[model samples]
Target: MMKRYYQDEEDIGLFQRMQQDDSQAFEEIYYRYFLKLSNTAFKRLQDRAATEEIIQEFFVNLWLKRHRLPELKNPESYLQTLLRNSVIDWFRSQTRQDGFAAERMAQPDYQIANATEQQILYADLQRAYESTVGQLPDKCRQVYTLHQRGYSVNDIAEQLQIAPKTVESHLLKAHTTLRHLLKDYSAVTITLASLLMG
Candidate 1:
């Protein structure tokens, strides 16, 4: 929930590296946020085991979708949002969403209305994100995915056993394609693109 001034540059750099599949960056992100994410989950579910599972799952999923991740504006907020969604899914799976919805509805009208709108917007954005990413060519998509997850150019080169130039070429094409694909989401194009692609 907090961003340190001194670590801001480092965090951004770390994410950039993670986008390229950097284990060090991935480990740092996990270590740095695991406890915070766990606490946030525990607060929502009040179940220690469930909270741990949710947080761990989120980190793993993030790695799986790293190629699709964008430059995160707020890493903590990003993880919180992921955890919130996970908790909601957990509640639904457990057949508790009805009660949870009722409790949420009992909140002040202003809060409920705002949250509702935000939820709808986020859902739409997520769909659009998937749609756009699904359009990339296979190799470009793979490169984009690997790089966004924190694989540096050289890392991707070594991992893919390709030349660094090839990795950069794929990255360039992926960026260009993504820009053209998401041009219509002018309002959130930049922010969403960053979030969806590192």
Candidate 2:
């Protein structure tokens, strides 16, 4: 199951399989988006059965039309938007009779978790970031610290009495090294990746 599931990670591979009506590939996508979409729908509908039915139907329709779908730059995002639209349609259909859709729509969207989870995530990110940075070579760490402190390349070079090219070199090397160290941490990955030259 793990080996089969891995085959669908790449968008191109998944797209190819769906073209041939591969159910395993379809199942992989179904499970990937199921929780997120179900949560989104339940946020609005507040009905577990209705949410499940809507998402189930959406996936059913998706499988039927998979082969003819056009190129998708981001399949996950596309599916998410589709799920949101499906929820909205559910709301509209219910509204014709209930007329209470607007109030429901005004409620907060589905949050993955509460404030405590957010704090824990932030702390984990900070630890991962600091630990990765702490593992850098002396010069690379120096350059990165200064860069984060708002130092320009030329300013960092001058302050450290190093060549501007050397400063850039250290930053690039640090970026690559930290990326490897922090690959499993999305927040850290984004923070480190954002250090590229403007």
Candidate 3:
């Protein structure tokens, strides 16, 4: 029988090279891992378009942070864990948002009245934050939004099939870029600016 190479061994070597900032190695890693990770995520999400988007975002992030990848005992296992967690998290967030909306809808007229200018300003700030986030490179924006929505760096990395260090790097770069872009604004504005500009 011809010797069959274990997938994990190939992954480890590619990951190590990616950590060294080798683009060729990272490309090899992406081709090798993207479909597998996407299929795994899709099994849980059951939304092919969303799952594919998520997987593409993940790989883009991996490329962006290839230099700081951490050593992994088993890349496939780690990715599987990430997909499971992300699916759970996505559902939880949907549940929370639904509950919040329901609660708002159930309020009495007196209790549900709209706010004044201050409240409007706050809302505007929130919108501005979202806008800033929209301005980020697609992958960076996705990572930032995921982080804000409570995904951990590890989870984000796994969902994206990249390294934890790469996640941090995207966040850091996003923050720095946002800070520079919104430095002149007030604290609230700055906060909004960073996220939107990210």
Worst 10 residues of 2 by lDDT: 189-198
As a TM-score, model 2 comes out at 0.46
Q: Please give the lDDT score for candidate 3.
A: 0.60
Clashing pairs in 3: 58-160, 132-196, 132-197, 133-195, 133-196, 136-198
- For all candidates, the clash counts are 23, 0, 6
Candidate maximizing TM-score: 2
Per-residue C-alpha lDDT of model 2 across residues 84-155, encoded as one tens digit per residue: 889889877866765465565445652434334555654565566679789889999999889766577889
In model 2, state the lDDT of residue 103. Answer: 61
Residues forming the 10-long window of minimal summed lDDT in candidate 1: 1-10
* lDDT value, residue 44 of candidate 1: 67
| lDDT of model 2, residue 79 | 83
Position 124, candidate 1: lDDT: 64
Relative to the true structure, candidate 3 reaches a TM of 0.42
- Positional deviation of 66 in candidate 2, in angstroms? 1.1
User: TM-scores of all models?
Assistant: 0.44, 0.46, 0.42
Sorted by lDDT, highest first, which candidate order results?
2, 1, 3
